[model samples]
Target chain A: MRASLKSFTPLILFLGLVVLLAFGLKTDPRKVPSPLVGKPAPRFSLPALQDPNRTVSNADLAGKLSLVNVWASWCVSCRAEHAELMRLSREEEDLQILGLNWKDDVVAATRMLRVYGDPYRVSAFDPDNQVGIHWGVYGAPETFVVDFEGTIRYKHIGPIDRTVWEQDLLPLIQAIRKTTNGHE
Target chain B: MNTNPAAPLVSVICEIFNRILIPIAPLRAILLTALLAVSTASAYTLEAFAFEDPAQAAAFRELIEELRCLVCQNESLAGSQAELAQDLREEVYRRFRAGEGRDEIVDFLVARYGDFVLYDPPLKPSTYLLWFGPFLLITVSTFFLIRTLLHKRQSPDSALSPREHEQLRELLDPHGSDRDGRNGPDQDKSDRER
Candidate 1:
């Protein structure tokens, strides 16, 4: 009886490991929580994608709720999320949506914008990805929600969909706006 | 052939040649092809970083390998061909060239990307399970194994009572031919005679 129980110990341990791994599998590895959440967003200045002579900086995003989306013309997910972003721009008139065009040819980025319809108030061209590095961007199709004080409140790491917009992002934006309006 | 003076030496040499070199020839060919395949596969263009100091360049290489690529979780920053990995490598090289210490550079990445960027996470409250979990399992298993062995050692001598021993003797000597009832000196002779 004792021998049988002793042999069963290994099976128990194996089952425990299986359960832990099963739980781990449910989590998306791509959605690792960013360290920049709740911290002030990084500052940067870059030439506008449409006009190289004109530039935009972090200062323009102050005193408003903003969405800073990191995207590239080559990123397929960016195209997938572009329509949602355009709809969001139309829906949220007060929300300032900015774009950081990461590591793409200027001509290609401009062409993509022309075809897809620009949703950003100002899309900053980041050919060298210097500003992207400062923003701690790992890849394209990442979005950050910055509060009125320019603090990054939330970060979405993949293509945004309607469900994500309604469930996670829109509620948070509304809450922040309510608090900011109360203070005013 | 047996009478030949050099027959034994020739046979020994043939045996050694057959045992060793015959098998190794094909294995060597396979290894050569594998090496060629690997070299050609990894010949894709990569961004290069120049450093004024060779030591700094070596440090940069080490640091990049130690950092994990967030986009490609399984690959190191140095090994990944992802664009983000390239940009990170560039960032590390830039920082190393700017006179940042290895710890400083790693800390900067950790601050921005969090501990996930590190292949080897630092020991802390949050990472205690990751760092010490294997050792904990080993220690627990060792404890149980030692306890089981100790219990087994004690059971044979102390756990068996006199009545149980008598029953065990009866079970072993089922024939019960001897009047002494125990397996004595006569029992061996009886078995040998049979």
Candidate 2:
């Protein structure tokens, strides 16, 4: 009996490892937690997408609740979320939506905005992706919710669908607004 | 089936051909193909960067491999063909050219993208499990294994009482013990007389 139990030890260890690996396999490795959450959003100044001569910066986004979306003309996922963004822009009057046009040609971005309907209050062109790097943008269509103090409150990695907007983002925004209004 | 002098030689040749050369032929082909694949796979174009010194260039290459491509997830910045990886490589290059050290560049990336941007995550409270979980499992397993081995070795020698030992002896040699018991004193007397 003792020998049998002793021999089963390896089998037990193997099973434990199998279980751990199975759990790991079920997880999506791309959904990495961002460090910028709860930290001050990186400051940047760039040429506006509409008019290259005009500039927009992070200073303009301060003292108001804002959603900064990083997107590019080449990104397919950005198109998927564009309609939702347009709807949100129309519905939510108090929330300011800013655009970081990541590594896109100005002409293409301008054309895309004109065709798709511009939801951004001001779209900043990041021709070299410098501002995108500062914002920790690895992929297009990443969105961040910034609070009144310019701190990044929440981040959404992929295309923001109706479910994600309703379940996660909407409640958080409401709660933040409540606290900020209470203080005021 | 031929009983000739040269038949054994012919059979030996056939055996060598069938058993050795036939099997090795496919294996050699596979090895050659694998070698070709590996050689072609490593044929990558050299990335152009103006470095102040060879050491800086080496550091730049090392840092690129150390950083993870967030978009690709599985590939390092050096190996990835993703646009984000290209941008990150450019960013690292620019930073290095501007006199930023390896640690400073890594810190800058970590600040923005978090430790996920690093291929090798630093040891901290949150990542302690990632770093040491396997060691912890090994230690626990080793403890249990040693305990079980020690118990198995010591149990037979120390666990039996004298009564239990007697019972075991009786069970093993019951007939031999009965004969010895009957002839014990007689055999001793006979041996003494001799």
Candidate 3:
């Protein structure tokens, strides 16, 4: 029995290595877990994208479950996610979708919103990317789920389609809503 | 040597180097220009933030060097030109100008971007494997290797037994004395013919 176990040692080690490597290969290296989750959302005050005269801030998102989406007109994936956002806006009345227009030309951003459809309840224009840096936004189309208390509940990197909305975001939102209602 | 398939190609290369390449003034000038361009390009200036105190400037330089650029994973904040990297550099500069200490600034970035923002990851429970994995592997491999060597040393002797030795002697020298009269392997054919 001792010899048999000894003989299988190499095979066992190889299998362990294979499993570890397979898991690593399946994971996306670009998706770094945000430390901002479970913490209060970063403070920011920027002019609204549609109306430059009006300002939007985190205070506006208070007392509502918010979806803060980091997007740019130049980002192709955001364009892909735009229709979904519109659909989500129409569907979920309680869920506030706040757009963060990051490091983009104002004219182009406005044009894209006009051409497609503006899904955001209020879009904050971050032309200098000062607010984006504070929010730890590395790429475009990153979505953050903020609870009614303005605490970031979850951060989803990459574009959100229907599958992502259903599989990941929807469940998390439901869970947060349940807990918040229970507390209330 | 002349029949070698690669001989002609080698000779052509040698001929080109001796004649066209070595004597070409414009080619040399172009190569010199390229070298100068690379050297000048490599000399980067951190002119965006200027501090009155040289120590503060040095600190700023050191801090950015230690910070990792998220967009380009392998590059330091000082070297990266990606939009996010630029924004991060500006943020670091802003923090320095605000009179925040290096540790405070690092903590601020770590809070936002996680520990990935720092080139040197902190010693923590999650990073224990990363910090000590090499030493553990070395210790394990050394233990196994020593055990193998000691086990090999303790193995039974491989010398032939007395009975086997006797059998080998008999096979080599069947006839104990005057073995010349015996039919040798090559001489067996001659003996058969006779």
lDDT tens per residue, model 2, A1-184: 9989979988998999899899999987877778899999888999899988888997878898999999889999999999999999999988999999988988899999999899999999898888888888878889999999899999998898899899989999999999999999
lDDT tens per residue, model 1, B10-39: 989999999999999999999999999998
Q: Considering only chain B, what TM-score does candidate 2 achieve?
A: 0.56
Candidate 3: list runs displaced more than 4 Å: B1-44, B157-194
Show the lowest summed lDDT stretch of 10 residues, model 3 chain B.
B174-183
TM-score of each prediction? 0.72, 0.72, 0.79
Instruction: Give the range where candidate 2 chain A is weakest over 10 consecutive residues by summed lDDT.
Output: A27-36
lDDT of 3 by residue, A1-184 (tens): 9999999999999999999999999998889899999999999999999899998998887999999999999999999999999999999988989999999999999999999999999899998988988898999999999999999989999999999999999999999889989998
Candidate 2, residue A114: CA error in Å?
1.8
DockQ of 1: 0.49
Candidate 2 error regions (>4 Å): A1-23, B1-47, B154-194
Among residues 3 or more apart in sequence or in different chains, the pairs in candidate 2 whose N, CA or C atoms overlap within 3 Å are none
* Residue-pair clashes, model 3: 0
TM-score for predicted model 1 compared with the true structure: 0.72
State the lDDT at A33 in candidate 1.
83
Model 2's DockQ score? 0.59
Model 2: per-residue Cα lDDT at residue B30: 99
lDDT score at residue A52, model 2, on the 0-100 scale? 82
Q: Which parts of model 1 are misplaced by more than 4 Å?
A: A1-16, B1-47, B145-194
Error of 2 at B84 (Å): 1.6
In model 1, how large is the Cα lDDT of residue B28?
A: 97
The order of the candidates by DockQ, greatest first, is: 3, 2, 1
